[model samples]
Target: MNILPLIVLFPLLGALILAFNPRLPNRLAALVGVGSIGLSALVMVWLNWLFYLGDGGGFTQTLWQWVTVGDFRMGFTLYLDGLSLTMISVITGVGFLIHLFASWYMEKDLEGAPGYARFFAYMNLFVFSMLLLVLGDNLLLLYLGWEGVGLCSYLLIGYYYQSEYNAWCAFKAFIVTRIGDVFLAIGLFLLFTRFGTLDIQQLLQQAPQVWQEGDLMAEVAALMLLGGALGKSAQLPLHTWLADAMAGPTPVSALIHAATMVTAGVYLIARTHTIFELAPFTLSLVALIGLLTLLVAGFTALAQTDIKRVLAYSTMSQIGYMFLALGVQAWDVAIFHLMIHAFFKALLFLTSGSVIIACHHEQNIFKMGGLWRSLKLPYACFLIGGAALSALPLVTAGFYSKDEILWLTFDHGYSLLWLGALLGALLTSIYTFRMIFIVFHGREQIHPHAGRGIAHHLPLLALALLSTFVGGMIHPPLANVLPAGPEGQYGHLIRVLTEVLAAVVALVGVGIAAALFLGRRRLIGNLMEAKEGDRLRRFFYSGFAFDWLYERITVRPFLFIARLHRRDWVNSLVNMWPALALGLNDLLLGTQNGRLRWYAAVMTGGAVSMLFLLLLF
Candidate 1:
């Protein structure tokens, strides 16, 4: 129990080691990088044992006094309970798996140069940031950790810095997310000013007493936090950066999209559920945003050709589901889905990484085919991962977690939202299996080199097993920590029907994918070959033209204004002195030349001028 701080410190030390000793032997660097996270996961397992085996109550650990100003004081502290336990479990547990797989994925780079060290350094640092975020007892520490992950996202996403395109992708992610971060900063300030402290438990306790339900301040603060959540989770308007984040290496995509950064929003909202409870309108708004983002991202996934981008959109859609759960006050359910999601989504992304590597780094699904036989392990893992993602009944973990959200949405009387979610589930199956069938079922387009070694096989097999009914059976430690989910207002029969419908839609979607993609893909291919289909394809592929629309209304206009003001009065004012200095130097230069006679004349003229000035004075 006392060693809780060490969980964060281990990864921090690992990052520091790799960062400073950038020339460590390749295998040792891998050991430090992967082993550090492995150690943290080991600590998490022990902590889980102690906490659960004991009274199963929340624990707060104050490591040190962080700061004091007059009467205001805050500590560098961590609070753990069911919610955070579930989170750090995903972070260190799944994060460790991702790190191990990365060692195999990035092995060539490990032999190449210091990039291997830099990559692991950033990886360890990212895990540390995420741990601090989920475990922090105070809002300030959480924000510090929040911004830390943002910086890491920028570094890891722009890892291929030799390419200008990848740099812009990282830049885009940073800038878009920064907008939401500003709103979050202001929200924290609002909370601090209202309560005179930023400790999360204190704030949650004090908020309901300080503000009544539907209070304007409460609503505003909740809205601000939602702004931050949307951006970080890749929800509406701020979501454009996520798909392009695939420009980084596949492992980066897995770490960021699968279990860490994109899920932070769901964690934030769940952690601050009390504050949001006071703001009913904002709570409903959160649900609406989640619904819309899920539908939007799910549709967008259908049009993507690049394998990683497809998974990237799937990540956005899945986080949208988590947000949907949060909106419905299914707090535990949200974290439940979050943990289950971490397993299957990480599985999918890691498998996709191998697929990309197997095809000699080809990412387009249409460009590679008949892989089911060639890459047997990855193909099987993908099938299981894709099935879990699509929420196949009984056998898959996603069916358990995600189906609960749908059932709860109906129980809470959000029937319209339930239907939307059902539609989203259908979309989920179509796009997921669509990727599976296209890449693995068609005639061979490119031969794939099968992935080998324990590093690769271990994560796939482990996550695949977890993506099954076995992982779904893993109970989250959230009963004491969170409010209960919507109790069956609609009763048992309705719940059964809804589950049946959801499962039916999922299977139906898979059948549609098989019909469309398995045999030459001609029916859909003809549709896509048509002018209108191609246009729609481009529209969906462009993320419903959000980027295009943003470019015109936001980005291009801002750039145009920037260009118009590029040489504006401010710059002119700053430049005037330099221009004046340069002009004076040029005038002085005109008085002399390189010629010796010109220099002598100048010297004589200067002496005559000095004498004349003295006489005149």
Candidate 2:
């Protein structure tokens, strides 16, 4: 009945086995990599069935007490609930599909057999770390998983360690996330100090009793947690690393962008909603940050030439919607969006991977043209994923989830926030269709072929189907399972009108993209070559110059200080004592000459001097 440990252990076991057995053949490694996640997914399915049949309340399974000092105790435990179950379902299910896709994607790594096995090893480890992050019962264990994902991301992102650019991107992802981890650690310490327990359920219960609404301590703690979420979720200022993260393999991009790294922040906020609720100011700040991030990332996506970078920014923007939902006290809606985003985003990235492979690993969209006939499966998959991403009316799952967030924003009286979200929706549709048109509409640039075998196409088909229809099926169940938020007292007519309005905005965006990219490609190209247009492109393309600004403000100053202290004055000062001792030794060397007469003379002189002193006394 306690199948929770198996969910995490399966992937961890596979990672260890693959890692230690470096001699594994490519075939065997692929089997192990894909099998491990598949088994985990199966176990999760079984657990879901059991959870539904049993009591609806959450359950915690403690493996052992991991740390103890006097009254304090921390356990290595797994927590199961509707929220975590949803997360693990996505992690294991979608993660398995990614693993399967990677088995094919990395089949012919330039590094050959060793590199192939190593890639799967890191992927399995990433799944394990992500599983632990969602299922952790205590803050300490969650932090362990938090840092674990960060490590796995660094390893996987730098999969091609030979490339300096890849290595730099990996380091950027690691270092930036670590900055957020520090805040999360501090928040954990604060929580433990306040309540003397790291157990999440107990902390949630105690938080309300000890801290009143808007309390300063509560606000600070909430903000620290928000900082962690910001970094992990790729929100606004901490978001630069994600676009660069496309330096990794396509599957790595899919995993990070869709199921694992970026979604962590949304989960963190949902899990700790109680803390955020206590800090009303922090909650408002969350909404504000989400609004800014969604719009900023949406525009950045428009300017990206690389296929994967566009999806990367889209992931950031989608996660922003989740944050916005949380900000408005729409907890269930946030999780709903997270789930829907995972499906379509993963599909989009995987489809892009197929395109990259078909085009001989070319990622620049401009370099790619009409492939609809040559690569039918990828084209279809891309269309479905793009439609879902654009929230195209009632046909795609994103429409339900995204429209709910937009409606809630307005219903809650945050009209400006709602307007920003509407603008973001329009932008999302534009970029989604824009990329679609650029890649699939123009004349064929190269003959394309679908990736070989069922491993490649099966996941894409499955995810594509989910992206189109999963929203309607999951909504009612998710509503039943998640904690409910306030529903505005709007009539059926008003609700219908809101949905209509959202759909129209999305359609208008798509229409504009179609007309500009599909109908008037030459004119757009000419405009792109214009001086003002070039300047505008560069601004958005560089993530609104945040990276450059950070370089000037943070990176350059730090580098200068490092160079200034390269000689290390403190080290020089420390060496001075030893240098003085050596000098004194040299000065005394003549007195220690290996001669008995010299020693006797020195002794006699000392004795004479002592007698002279006695006479004088």
Q: Against the unseen true structure, what C-alpha lDDT does each candidate score?
A: 0.92, 0.88
Across 131-225, the per-residue lDDT of candidate 1 in tens digits comes to 99999999999999999999999999999988999999999999999999999999999998899999998899999999999999999999999
Lowest lDDT 10-residue stretch of candidate 2 = 475-484
TM-scores for every predicted model: 0.95, 0.92
Off by over 4 Å in 2: 109-113, 476-482, 487-489, 575-617
User: After superposing candidate 1, which stretches have Cα over 4 Å from the reference?
Assistant: 109-113, 581-617
Q: Which predicted model would earn the best TM-score?
A: 1
Cα lDDT for residue 298, model 1? 91
Q: Could you give candidate 2's per-residue lDDT for residues 1-617 as a string of tens digits?
A: 58789999999999999999977898899899999999999999999889889775788888998998887777898988888899998899899999999888888434364577788899999899999999998888888898889898899889888899999999999999888888999999999889888888898889999999999999999999999999899997788899888888889989976667789988898888889989999999999999999999999999999999999999999999999999998888898889889899999999999998889888899888888878889999999999999898888989989998998888877889998999999999999999999999887887777777898879999999899866546752344344576667667687788889999999999998988899558777887899999899999999999999999999999999999987798978998999999999998997999999999999999999999999999
